[model samples]
Target: MAELAKTSEAVHRDYTGAKIGMWLFLFTEILLFGGLFLVYAVYRTKHQADFHTAAAELSVAIGAANTMILLTSSLTMALAIAAIRRSAKTASIVFQSLTILFAVIFLVNKYFEWGAKIGHGLYPNSPELLAQSHGTILFYGLYYVMTGLHALHVLIGIGLLLTMLILTVRDRITNTDFVKLENSGLYWHLVDIVWIYLFPLLYLIT
Candidate 1:
């Protein structure tokens, strides 16, 4: 009995450590994006007209759709964690699957959006973009850099959630030991929150 007690205490300690580690990792991510946001603010202030014109080139409809998709995914991800906590394994799997689907959809939308921009010669280092004013050039440069980074994060989140889904399927993540899923959910939420900020700064800026 003492042995079992010791093992349980060790597991609890591991869980606590894992949670703290994830939070620290998230804090670092926040700092990375926060610095970029500060850079964006400075440039936008210097070239408000260029920023407004550049933002006009982006499609609000597409941006709004992707925002809704990510918001829904966040909801589904939370539901997945909640379902697992309640020991509803099937519901958890369903929600996880839905979250993955939404993520894929988002990427697909981004693909077409990027393709259209590239087709129009808006991509970085392209002759068309190089001809633009200094402010316009800076705006597009920041747009591509920031949004590309955020998209990379989305891809990483998808991979993490996929791993969590597989673990849950294998019963490695269950009601009593689901910190892995919780951590993945937190990462996914960070991705979503970053977009919440990005959508406005990149898409809705006027």
Candidate 2:
């Protein structure tokens, strides 16, 4: 039974390695956003008035709604992990599906929000945007870049969660071996946390 023992050891090593790898990847993501946040702080300080005025153009109602959506998705993701750990496969699948649904709703809201701004000629490099104060320009630039990046992450999270759902259905991610689901949930939470910061910084600058 030495072979069996060696196989068990290898599986344990792989599980530990996967967790470490996911954490390292998340750290790099944090670094990327951290640098952008620093840049935003510098610019906002240099042109506080312009930043405030520009932020007023954003719809607080919509931003708050999206914030709620992501927060709910984070909750569903956590519940998904908890469900799987308890061997409630169907419950896990439902929670995962709900998480993805919330993500989609968040993106839909963002799409309309961006469309409204674009229709009003507020987007980067638009004639109206170019005519705005330098601070206004910088504010919109950072807003678009940061929010767009976060939306991309949400899309990626949806895909990851969808995969997890499929795997759960196929019995691949059972109660005993669910590290993959856990990793996906961690990533999804990061996306939500990023939006939590972004909403206040970009949408509530008053």
Candidate 3:
């Protein structure tokens, strides 16, 4: 009985330590985005009317759908970690795959969104600058900067999920060593949270 208690305590300690480290990492991420947000705020203040006009051109429905997709992925990520810590390898793999699928779906939606916008002359330094309004161009610049950074994060997240998937399938992860899973999931959640702010800001700035 005491042996079992010792094992449980050790596992708890590992999980707790990993979670604390992840939180610290997230703090750094916050500062990274914080600088971007500061820049965005300055731009928005300088061009509120232009930002609103540009935001109006965006598809709010697609932005909302992407938000929900990411939120769902976050939930699956949580379950994946839970399954790993419980030693349910099959369940962990299934949840991890689901999380990846959702991440891909979000990416596809973003691709179409950006492609269509670019097709319509909505990108930084687009040729429309001479013929079109500057406000619209400014909006496109902000959109490109924000969404481009976000897409980079999403790509990183996909890689992280794939790694977790491999580790879960090979039985390399176990109840005693699920710290990596927790760490990756923390990063995944941070991506989702960042999008939560992005969705409303970009889709409904008006």
Candidate 4:
């Protein structure tokens, strides 16, 4: 029994190590966005009027819709983890699939929103934006940069969740060895948290 105990301990240690690595990577992501937020705060403070004007141009309805979509996705992701832990493989897959569906919906909304903005010649380096006030230009610039980066993260999260779904189907992520699913859920939640902050800052600023 001593040999079995040693093997079990090693497995637990590896799991703990994996969790630590994920947390550290998440911290780095926080710092990356933290810098952008700092710059935004400074610029917004100095150019509140222009920022408000630019923010008014954004579609609050679409932004709010995307916010709801992502929040629901987070819920579905959490449910997926629970379903897996309960050994309900099919339920877990369904929840994860729902999460991915929500992600795709969010991206579709963003694509249309951005397309409208670009159609109006409001994008960065466009003559329309170049002729705008410095604060307005800065507002749209940050909007695109921040929201675009966040969307990229959403895409990455979709990929991760899809992989988790496949693993669960193959029994590679069974109830007894489901850290991969849990970690993927954690990452999804992190993405949702970032959007929680971003939605208000960009869309509700007026």
Candidate 5:
């Protein structure tokens, strides 16, 4: 009985430490993203026409769809953590699985959208990338740069979620030891949150 109480207290302290560290790491990430956003703002003001034209070229349908998918994934991820907190291992696993599925959907949407743009000469160094308009070329160049970076983060988030899925399935990590899981979820949520801010700014800069 005393052993269980001691274990519980130790677990509580460890959880607090892990979560705080993750939050601090997220703050650092915010600063990085903030700097990039600053650069974007400067370019946007200098080339408003080109920026608008570039924004228009982005497919709103796919962007909006991915936004919804990521939002849903965030919700599922939250649910999974909640389930773990409640000591419902099976429910947590199920929610984590769903979160992974939503992540894949988001990746697929991003891939298709990006690939189409690149195929249509929307990438730097591509023969058709510049679209013959000064604004189009500059705007598309920035577009690819920003979205490409964000997409890389998305890919990393997917890998993190998959790691959680594996840990849950293999019983290698359970609710009792969910700090790594929580940390990964934190990272994934940050990725989603960054996109939430990026989407409207990048796509609606008119």
Candidate 6:
């Protein structure tokens, strides 16, 4: 009994350490995005008219749809973690699959969105965009950079969820050892939270 207690305590300590490390990494990500957002605010304040003009060019429907998709994915991710903690492997896999599907849907929407913009000659350094006011150019520049980075994070989150799915299927992540899924869930939630803010800022700028 004493040996089992010690083993459990050690696992608990390891899990705590891993959580601390993950949180520290997430903090760094926040700082990275924070700098971009600061630049965006400064530019937007200086060029409010151009910013609004450019923002009007964005598709609110697509942005809102992607927002809902990400929000749903976050829910599924949380459910996957909960299912794994309950030792419900099949349910966990299903939830993870749903999360991945939603992520892909978001990317597909983004692809069409960006493609439309490019088709209309709105991409960075494109003649149309360059001909626009400095504020319009800056808006699109920040839009591509910030949202592109967030999309990369979405791809990474999808990979992480897929890994969790594989591990769960292999019985490597179970009720007794599910920190991997939990951490992935945390990362996925962070991705969704970032998009939640991005949606309003980029799509609903008034």
Which regions in candidate 2 have their CA more than 4 angstroms from the true location?
Answer: 1-14
Pairs clashing in candidate 3? none
Candidate 3 C-alpha lDDT tens digits along 1-206: 99999788776665676789899989998998878888778878888888887788899999999999999999999999888778888998999999999999999999999999879875677677546676666667767888888889999999988998898777767777778888999999999999999889889988
Q: Please, what are the lDDT tens digits per residue for candidate 5 over residues 81-107?
A: 889878888998889888889888887
* Residue 24 displacement (Å), model 4: 0.8
The per-candidate count of clashes, in order, stands at 0, 0, 0, 0, 1, 0
How close is every model to the real structure, measured as TM-score? 0.95, 0.94, 0.89, 0.94, 0.88, 0.94
Shift of residue 42 alpha carbon in model 4, Å: 0.5
Q: For model 2, which pairs clash?
A: none
Query: Which of the numbered candidates is closest to the native, going by highest lDDT?
Result: 1
**lDDT tens digits, residues 58-142, model 4?**
9999999999999999999999889988999999999999999999999999999999999999999999999999999999999
In candidate 6, the residue pairs with backbone N, CA or C atoms under 3 Å apart (3 or more residues apart, or in different chains) clash, namely: none
lDDT of 4 at 137: 94
57-120 per-residue lDDT for model 1 (tens digits)? 9999999999999999999999999999999999999999999999999999999999999999
Off by over 4 Å in 5: 1-13, 131-134
TM-score of decoy 2:
0.94
lDDT score of residue 118 within candidate 5: 72
lDDT of 2: 0.93
Q: In lDDT terms, how accurate is model 1? A: 0.94
